[model samples]
Target: MTSTPHHQPILDSPYVLDLFAGPGGLDVAAHVLDVPSLGIEWDRSACLTRYAAGLDTLHADVSAIRREAFESLPPEINVLAGGPPCQTYSVAGSGVGRKALDEVKGYIERLMAGDSDEKIDKELQKLSDPRTALVLEPLRYAIQATRSPNRGHRPYDVIVLEQVPAVQALWAHYALVLKNIGLPDGTKYQVKVGVLDTETYGVPQTRSRAVLIARRVGLGEPFLPEPTHQAYEAKGWNRGNGEAAALTHQPSLDEEITPEPVTRRGKSGGPLPWVSMRMALPGRRKPFLVRSNYGSSGHPGRRGVRTDQQPAATVTGRISRFVVFEHLDENVVYEGPRFSMNEAGMLQSFPPAYPWSGTAQAQQVGNAVPPLFGAHLLSAALGLPVPDPEALREPWVPATEEERAKLRSQGCGAADDCTARCPRPEDQAPPRSVSQKKKLSAG
Candidate 1:
């Protein structure tokens, strides 16, 4: 593992336990900031990457793990963090495309009813898309952790959860549930939920996620972390004048759909430039078309081309579909070169020296919470000092032939190491007898 330069642990309860911790994004951030952390992930490929990175992880299904099992851990895990698989909740996901929201709402209601584990499991078997309910796992774990025990409960001091923007309302509803149900200490958990753009947190990507945070009795209501970086639009940028907006590294496609630019220093001024693709990829500045796996049919969505000057669109699991758009000057666009695994990793803020061992390299990278953004959230949750966005950028360079050989020496691929591969979420036919709208309304 590469050495972390400026980490100072300062949380009331610094130990963090991450659920659905794919590729250790939150774990990486917590650890680098000197917080003791543990990750639980079921995917073998994800576990392999976690292992190669030297992160502490439990290679088992999150559903199978019980809170009592955490008794053996040290420092009394006070923070609970998770980003359950978002495949079912993403706008680009097949689940949403299939119009599964009504069924999803029913699942949430069932979960809220506090159905028995056996019943929930059986219901899951019946659902066409069980992954939609996986979002409840974090809340389930939290409730289990905070229940009064024969022995005094070690209630989590803070809880942080994130998902795609489509799940924002679900998390908001969860916040209300958490508020209604008091912890073992008979204190209501203060909760906050919202949507945040990754670029605002200095991630070199234009991804938006739904965030939910809860703090124990005394801490009061928690707040979402404020953005430390801005891109696309600066507060006072005069579009009429030639003067560019703050951090306008990339050209906007259109005014209607474009994300407003931001800067480190609000409307006034900030020193650092947004970390553009050019800054991260170095030397690969030409424009290019990112071919879609969907081809011309364009069912889910069309693959997009990104310029070196801007943060990239959300990186998807199928990143191989995104080929670079080669071009001459600004007008001519060509297609062909695809992003290497390392390039994707850098954009996600993984350290340059990270040992990557996984079959679906792009999938693992795409699924990760960017470590820089994670750190920003962690700092906010713990009331610690947030790092400067400028300080977060590390130089990314292509692997040399020798480095490639060493990576090979690490392991074949996560496929070989992982005991089980996560399957695509199935679409279960909705219940015939019970009315879907009625069930959702019952909650």
Candidate 2:
């Protein structure tokens, strides 16, 4: 890789095109690693955020951009990445996709059996939730890039896809298809598919996602990246058979937990002591509790609670609904300030001042692939050295005013509703320094 003082790092195959890109999470990781990328996202809010963050974006649906358009694009696009919308497949949402799993598998089988896109799309229209078919868009793109006539006449050097763990089986099908397909040069792809725990990648949240990675045959065999941090396990809670047992109460403070040396190795030989909410959001004078909006153990009223010392529960679009409590003793509660956009973004491993624009900002943050985790995935896919987790953990500075201005000049800011959608400097909260003394409730 080569980089200049004023330019991004240029790799042998630097260009990436991310389909169904939500708020440029993977794009942020690509930028950090010096790989230039463009994201295609239909959500206006997500596109606005991407523009605010100075990311290359095309505000269009993945399906709308057909194979011809893809083939017409610059041939330097060697990497294809995406995390398709997972609402239908998510256990937290409607079980429409789960119910239609067999239908989807049949479609995949047809695609592998040389079925045409038009036929598959026609069959997909019969599904109850159309979004269920979006999961296969990545596979469609992969097939087109490799088999269809294009400028390069070569397959994408690397391909990465991610979605809810419910889509793991679908990814397995994708792995099979990709492995069997070859480029005009007879070079096939090496594929790996599995579910990864975000916490193991040093994210300050316990979210699991199914990921698929593919590389050209000649490139080193494709494999998932190894863990860089220990997975989060509740200190005093026992979880078995998907049931949470009674909690052995402990103080919700960093000092309350036994201090394990950071240098210590985990069972996976990764760093010891998983990152906690306290570590991710510093400068808090007191520990606090986050009460999730959703229920736990099939009890509607029993809201899930995680102390600052624990890694946060999986963040979702409903994050704003979660209540933060300065004090919670049984039923009694003292409500505290909720996490700011910056804090939420930080937990997702985005830069502190990643200019979040437009409405449903929390949803944008929640839907993102944690940049740190994305970095690891991209590194592994591109045959690059894994980045230092500690370096990624450090506070990230906000984009400079000049940089933001440049983005705006390049048509990155929200159009038509700039005043309402574009993020202001004051709107962003910088990472709190350790030396700064502030209450947990302080904004």
Candidate 3:
């Protein structure tokens, strides 16, 4: 009998290129639901994501990706995903070090070819392979940051681009860069920059992002993704015609989010539901009386403080080492002013049993992406079923009895709550899996 070539699955999940992958939070989320992903990360925690998932991984910077690598790959890599190191615009590390998105601005400028080939090669290394990058940014930062000495000194791309409300201003800089490089005002790539909340999309935190959608296909103004969940509305925008009542009456930001989708002569979907802090990563008990320090509140001149009763602010690649908890002696535990690495990562949403590898001397858990948050974003993009809130109640694996007590006292509903915080069942997970029987290879 003659051997035949194997046919590929048409419905096979699209391959993804994770850029500036950090600790692969985005890849982990997509992988949890079975989305095929290839990640490029300069950091070790992100490399561990591939090892944990039985997938291929490359250690490199995103901007440094080698385009020649793609010539040999399959054509199905439908998506290029990433949240490039937002340190330049991040609210947490906003110190004297290139505050207010300066570094990201520089990165983007380099991305547009204004920088030296060597510099671009260095930054591009953040990606294991080469592909166009999609950036997420706020309107103000978008415009102000992209300003260069060569700018003709005018906001561009406002013509064909549909301004995603709230952060339309943020698009000023991004739009300008494309225009300055002589790219036309037409479909440079589907760009949508707006202030979106996770709660409105059915996640808990009141996180708002200046999301931008880019498609290499040159489709003019990528349609604003139809929102599946509804929570808040702008002060005056009316309900979209034909929006479902179930989606409109959300208890979220009350009237702060966009109302039900009402169509003008044109429109397809409504805003996503805002999953309140209570809904997404909800606690068994109510959070303390506080809004959110989610933005740039941690800046020195800015006054912001976190309390034990509240879900933590967004967890980043570094700070995963600090543990957070409430003291039965009330808030006494916090008085010590430190947390176990395991405790901090859990609050940010890593799974309870996922193993991490690195020396204690190395920042293992600190270099991670909150898997839960990453998963939710993937669900929205792939149109996969959302994670059932109740089903997410996995018991965390704990390191010690004291850690167990810490979770129990905090009203943990599952045994794994402790482990979810640390992810290391034994010591830590490494970039390479211990199970030698298996191997991860690239297509």
Candidate 4:
């Protein structure tokens, strides 16, 4: 695992160093904002995807970088961002981290008390899963950054971290620690931590993540990004009044499903409607219904259904198990298509032709922070203007026949197989219509 130069040069200022950077999710957002970033990821598959996406990546463990190479980071890198491994903390996975919360807090206290790395490492090994200890890596990096100014290493001015909603308590503890640890310049950090809904930020999927944003007190106060889209409310179910009703019946395959009316507004009075699956992946000839493999409300056999009219349910590594079918009358039942890798990526707000590589790409896409959401988060964290929701939802043109042929000639089967020469969404002409956009599938 080593560093490789990307097609684009790393910028000289406001650079980001991303830890546990799986498949360049935040990196994509940084690139869109013209902020250069270097991601440190240990997974070979994810690193391969990062290289394919033209994202600068150091293919190594975050712990290794923090310990053996912290001082080697470029002085221009002033932003620290990461989404640590969340499997242990995710509700969908084993609850080891949740059960071990107090122990983790103890480690945080020990670290703040100046415990030696060796002593912490010895205790961390005692966890049921060693990855549980990785969650503290970001805190370790933050603490190191605060103390490094005397050694010629510039302390990170902006720190952003995210994980499963289960980590909100951990982030709360982080806020307290960061505020007390004054920078060498005698300025403490302004910290904010909370849970954010991805759909509220215009991501097409309904996912919740715990986020922490910190900045030096001399900089502007830290605050969470405001919601730019209305939060999603699943049709036919009312949690507010404890009322339940059957979902509206499916329309015929040829009939279009009208979008639900939305009049919600934010403080800016400009928040848009929650983005739907149909809006996110337009150009389908037939209306489709997605049947989730997993059940809801303790019904192990009851698969959940989401109409094209709504935002997709939280995408998981097992998204391949989800089946998509043509919307038909209730009397009929048949096998339907599963979402293609590209379709899944788009549902997660990746560009139509984003170069996903290696195996477990669905997992990679599922684990990633939606780049669209990342853009808004980063914009707020950096005190930049938020990106327009309409602009973010603008459809991307699929690869042209000529582009596909050129890729084929280069011995590439798909855009993801190409590297530096991969065609970018901005490089292509906009499609004349949504139907025309589907002319060339990334599949």
- Candidate 1 stretches with Cα past 4 Å from truth are 1-10, 67-75, 90-115, 148-151, 183-185, 231-267, 270-273, 283-303, 327-336, 389-443
Error of 3 at 58 (Å): 1.4
Off by over 4 Å in 3: 1-13, 53-55, 67-74, 88-187, 197-208, 216-309, 317-342, 359-369, 379-443
Across residues 167-224, which tens digit of lDDT does each residue of candidate 1 receive?
7777777777668855434556788888777776677766777888788767754767
lDDT of 2: 0.69
lDDT for each residue of candidate 3 in 265-304, tens digit (9 for 90 to 100): 1234544343332332333232222222223212221112
Model 1 Cα shift for residue 177 (angstroms): 1.1
lDDT per residue (tens digit) for residues 52-170 in model 4: 66676665668877777777666677788999876566544455556767677788877877788888888787776667788899778866775665446556788899887878898
* Model 4 stretches with alpha carbons more than 4 Å out: 1-12, 90-96, 146-151, 181-187, 237-268, 295-303, 328-333, 389-443
Question: Model 4, residue 72: what's the lDDT?
Answer: 64
**TM-score for each model:** 0.72, 0.78, 0.49, 0.77
lDDT (CA) for every model shown? 0.62, 0.69, 0.39, 0.69
lDDT of 2 by residue, 1-443 (tens): 11112212224766888888889889988877788998877676787787667787766657766533666556778898989876666544455556767677677666656688888888887776677787878767766765656555666778899887888888887777667854334556788898888888777888888899887777667778777677666543422211112222435434443323333257776466677777777744455667675543233323477766777777777777777765454334477888888888887877666778889999898889889889878877876666555545455554455655554444334333344323344433334433453654464
TM-score of 4: 0.77
Model 3, position 370: C-alpha lDDT score: 47
Ranking by lDDT: 4, 2, 1, 3
